[model samples]
Target chain A: MNDAQAPIVPAVEVLAFDIFGTVVDWHGSIVRELGRRYPQVDGDAFALAWRAGYKPAMVRVMSGELGWTLIDDLHRMILDAILPQFGLERLGEEERRELNRVWHRLDPWPDAVAGLQRLKRKYLLCTLSNGNLGLLTRMAKRAGLPWDCVLSAEVFRAYKPDPATYLGVARVFDVPPDRVMLVAAHHDDLAAARACGLRTAYVVRPLEFGPAHPKDVAPQAGNDLHSRDLLHLADLLDC
Target chain B: MNDAQAPIVPAVEVLAFDIFGTVVDWHGSIVRELGRRYPQVDGDAFALAWRAGYKPAMVRVMSGELGWTLIDDLHRMILDAILPQFGLERLGEEERRELNRVWHRLDPWPDAVAGLQRLKRKYLLCTLSNGNLGLLTRMAKRAGLPWDCVLSAEVFRAYKPDPATYLGVARVFDVPPDRVMLVAAHHDDLAAARACGLRTAYVVRPLEFGPAHPKDVAPQAGNDLHSRDLLHLADLLDC
Candidate 1:
């Protein structure tokens, strides 16, 4: 690796994680659930379509078109809109509510639990997800993700890519932004956290979307560390 | 026990804890630490004075006399004020800072960890304390308190006895108020949660102010459950 690409070790006291794609297999979890419920449907396409609606829904709330809404509500709205398109509009309110909660039941990446246990010995670990606190709490309990704290956009009343969410983690811990590192699978999240003066570590989740549509795992220029997965990130951090 | 004194079981989905004197032994912990540092001083009196400053400090913030300040700052303010009276004003900045963090290092009650582990299997566990998120998180990490969520008055911008802090627990989980139980040693905290339509569990912490001053452990009229300690609460909850 070139000098610019080498990992820059700073004085990091906290690690804030991006939950959905970085720590958990959201798309794969959704696809598996959908396949179980409706074997005839194209589960992959449905999973992708549901996730595709996430950003725009968040944009509406961020732009104040809708009053502050939790990710659970946003997921339900998206699920309701896409169910008819997938010819599954017959699902009842209870079914839809249960289906919408698939986000809470997303399976963690294989390295996530063990890697977190290792890194948690050295630094504070928290979720910096757009997911609501309840959702994050349930997910952590179910997945055995040993987070020192669970923070959400619901807490800051702002979503990721917004500076408040990234900066809020540091403020909660009473630490400078540079002492907190944002660990994620997405470059956009790392960039936003970096913009807020936080250190950044990118862990590539190649199958974030699924096997058919692999996410780009290329190392971005400004991130302090880049690794194949969470375990690799732990190794790089000397955990 | 009479009808009013008997445990009234409810479908509580979450157990919201009052951290300081409930799950942890703040007075005992503070006195022990203070005794170790200032061997010639009256550590019990010093500890009580420090804790006595807590509610009034929170009242200042709650009454809008002060801006939204964290408990950590309040502790520091109280520490600085009481140091002179205790003949410990000779301590420097770094020593003072470390001393102020005694709250973060307070040990849990003997049954706190095991009782919480059992209750956690049956219900979601969270802290609903006036303590700041950082303090609670650090305390949990140090004392091995397994909270699914670390909530604080800082999150609600209001301290205990505020309806916002009580109802906020239910709102976070998208559950009705009764599904969230406030488990506290203080009657006022439990009463506030009850007034907000939440279930209330009162745990007795008789030595909260140290062995010289035992707190009243009489069962209140309104609490749905009363127990000698957290382990008893776990048994009452059928956990």
Candidate 2:
């Protein structure tokens, strides 16, 4: 296939990643960590329920109902609310803090490290995530994600799907939005980036939610590129 | 010789770097690049004069005399101010802009890559630089800097030596200030970081300026650690 850098497309100077499910296997990593720590609990259910609370928590911040909260604090808020329901309330504060850091230790999808290296050679690569700088930095350290830089909504004090968050990547690199392609698994994230004039690359993470949660595999319209995974995106970009 | 983690000191969780003279040989690199591009001009004088304008320009942003400006822009501002003094006023806008990007391609000091890799094993290594995110990211790409995150004064809209910039590293990692150490060649930078309760590691950069600029070779008071270079710091930290 012709690379995304073919003459027909606008030249992209930077490739910003959405992170979480898009780059790291968040659900699997969470479930595995939870299961390992709490063998008695249904880790799958806990992981899903915890993740389910993420956006709504951000909405509170985004809508001005809640003051600005770091992902670490927000993740703890959800974890605390759901722990008792799962009978894991017996965990001590230190243990809860340790568990909350599981997000900081997520395993990269098998392709992520290698794929990013390839893409990074040709284009500037960075994280354009809702994750806080601390969380993203720790995750990159633990997972060996070779990002040129780790950028976050915490820097902009805005959440993903917010135009500022999408456009902020462009701002950081001082590139036009069209010269920055957001590569992500989520349609909404790509849509937001596109709305803000960024080129979008949609990659399918079929098991992003594990087997129980069926995800859309179809490529969305208006995306500049689509791929099976980051390696494929690397191939498509001739990286 | 124990790792910096020895019982005598606070357990530093993050090692934030001061780039430019500390990590990259800015004087040598800038002089070399400038000399390569403009053999007719005195690159040494140009380089020193360029740097000489840096702090005063930053003072504008820091004191609200001017709004927040990225170092790249400020560097250009300095470059333009000194161009006429060097009889290089005829340099076009595009050439001046291209030349301004020389800051982004600084060559790392010999031990930086290996030392940083070692430090990364034990500490969350990051760039706590006044350079804008774009410049830092590009420098990392060019120099193989293994920063876990590239943070900037731009993120806080405050320049270094400010309380906000020092405390901001700890805030990013959600660690105590003492758990974050500022590693730099500049006593003033380390002094400010220490005042904010951050641990400090002062590394000597003997030739940060060309032979003409005799820098202070003695260690300053208040720094928690002293090293000949990053490799020595890595050894001291037991990384």
Candidate 3:
């Protein structure tokens, strides 16, 4: 999209990304691991079902209906419920806990490392994911994701779509809202960020839901830039 | 010092450094700027007095005698109080605020960038300074001090020498206290970390004060390693 046609916002200073679908291939990573652990289970279905549980779990916590729960805990809760449904059994508690931690070892997209490096040179880059701090820190180290800082919902005690999370990034860097941008695969996340007077970048992850599941193809206007991947976003941002 | 004679502690996994006097020469930066701004003022004395206000200001916040205040705010308060003592005329509020923020722009020691780069490869290196998030983030970007994360007492809502501040690093990285090492020039800061079960490394910064002002030359026990500079520490750590 042309810069003029895009939402006219101040030049972005910090770019905060949504981790699971946007930067890392969560579905593919989970499916691969599921295939290895449960040979009889439909790995793709199990991966999608596990992710489908993510939002509702977060919503329970965000609405005060449930007490504050870290993403690591939420992931484990989902894992337990799904294991029986998938006909998986006999795994020890310690092994099951380690398996649940597979999210922390998710692989980055092919262009993620190069794109982040380019963007980091010009703009302050950080993670604004629902992932907990410990999980995100370990993932960055394992995946070699270079970030100026790793910020999470864990730090703000609030999840995404909450104004507090977006505003927290601004407060952390001591910058104005317009100077910080939220980059995500989900249009809803970008919309929330734009509503809060922050810039937005939409990165399309067509395979995020696996080959059987269709991606969101509808066009959006709130996004300051829309691209196929992080590298394209970097090019459009002139980083 | 030889490793054999060093205090027995688990080998340091992460080295958290005290920034002002340890990684960066705050005295030199402040004194040089002072001389440039006010030729008539005693720059050396002014720098010493400004730094002297730091600990007392932090103590008030730590003791709960004063409300929680960040290092940036504390520096501004001290600046306002001391400006008149130096026989300086009233400056605009904006100018005074800008002057106080000079701490955020302090230059790193010559060996700092290179030493941190070497150490980062073998260890998880971070800042455990009294400086707030905004200050440390800007300083890292400005000085190219490679850090895995920029941590501060701000995260703990308590200043250094407090057990919470020392233990907070261990909590953040999910590592045992003994694996996290405190690297600093001051005996008191190192002592506090050691008391809290963290390893300690003392890096002597003889010129941290100007030539006229002498620093403590005596080495103390409870320090796991003592080095002349960051590069020397890099050698001892076998980085």
Candidate 4:
């Protein structure tokens, strides 16, 4: 909960990360890119609206209302629905497609690259995000995030909060679930991983929803560790 | 077939690689490790024997004679079977497990890392191996192989030469099959990839089976490109 009371580091062999808001600043990235491309658009509101559709879209697929769909396709569906509301329905096919790939090019938080590099020296690092493999791979390449392995819900055919997604990391490494740590900014994602028996490291990303909506960064009850950001996480883990 | 008559490079967005014999020297690595660990044993014969069981083991899983098994498990099965013949039946469980993981610590060919770094600058690079994700990920991490993504038969629930495995690479990147190139030392693998409409680059690994059994590094028909090794392939691609 605090530096003075930091828990003893668990013997975690792999650190599985959540990508969208945890590793990359999706809200800030979308807002910046949208404003640059379409000056007249309310990028802040547009960014929020686009992301607001994400959970429900995944729910649709999970509920079988939609067949198995990739996050890229889901993003496009959300984009198409919100375009007219943002007065951008006139965007061309190529532009809309490129815009959708912005998710693949989202920038990392300031401390992310450095922290991951430090952590990489000590443990196997991977992504356990709901983002598809292609998106995570391209994003890591673009952002210079040095991931030892790029994993996604696509690999498991199930999204976050599913026991399969969390346990899949342990299965991949042939380790017990407790030997894998879920490093995430969201409590729900960590809770799901915890429920699956993984260690959890809570990373505070206060501006994950952008400055207009600050997220609570308070330490939660079940997490094994808490840190201000990935840098602090690396330090806390003694990386 | 030769540099004087090298085929024009195909327009590929992703370079998917075959791991075991192509990128890393499993035979050599095992031979060296076994010789070091068991001075009384004929390491060369032991290495070949262990490898000889690989295909048959996969066939059992593929034919549903056994449930879907990871390479790590397959390797252990082979090790357990061959240990008696090699007088290693006395090996403890922990030792057998560690020996089985030698597959994960195989040494990369000298040019692999450098050539991959060069190619990484131009294309999305990933492993499309029949090796399970855990083995491939550990091998890449230990050997300093910079893979953008680690894909495996485990992810597809299918093994090499399966159309699903070949096509899965293209599907992962949302690219047309021809826009994905399969680079491998094995003719059968390239042929399988080619049949799935993917481009093929034949990388010669003459020492894959050890100097006592040097493989013929001939450029076969239907392969889009051929090279002495990964470095030469990088050169042919202007990487």
State every prediction's TM-score relative to the real structure: 0.96, 0.97, 0.92, 0.97
Candidate 2 has what TM-score? Answer: 0.97
Candidate 3: lDDT of B200? 89
DockQ, structure candidate 4: 0.84
DockQ of each: 0.82, 0.87, 0.55, 0.84
Worst lDDT window (10 residues) for model 3 chain B? B1-10
Candidates' lDDT values, in order?
0.91, 0.90, 0.85, 0.91
Cα lDDT tens digits, model 1, B158-186, are 88889999999999998999999999999
Better of 1 and 4 by DockQ: 4
Task: Give the Cα error of residue B160 in candidate 4, in Å.
Answer: 0.6
Identify the superior model by DockQ, candidate 2 or candidate 3: 2
Model 1 ranges off by over 4 Å: A1-7, B1-7
Q: Write the per-residue lDDT of candidate 3 for residues A100-154, one digit (tens) a residue.
A: 8899889998999999998888898889999987788778878888888778887
lDDT of 4 by residue, A42-147 (tens): 8889999999999999999999999999999999999999999988999999999999999999999999999999999989999998899999999999999999
Best candidate (score: TM-score):
4
Question: What's the best-to-worst order under TM-score?
Answer: 4, 2, 1, 3
Which scores higher on TM-score, 2 or 3?
Answer: 2
Q: Show where candidate 3 strays beyond 4 Å.
A: A1-7, A35-41, B1-11
- Interface RMSD of every predicted model, in angstroms: 0.6, 0.6, 1.6, 0.6
For candidate 1, please provide the TM-score of chain A on its own.
0.96
Per-model fnat list: 0.77, 0.84, 0.39, 0.74
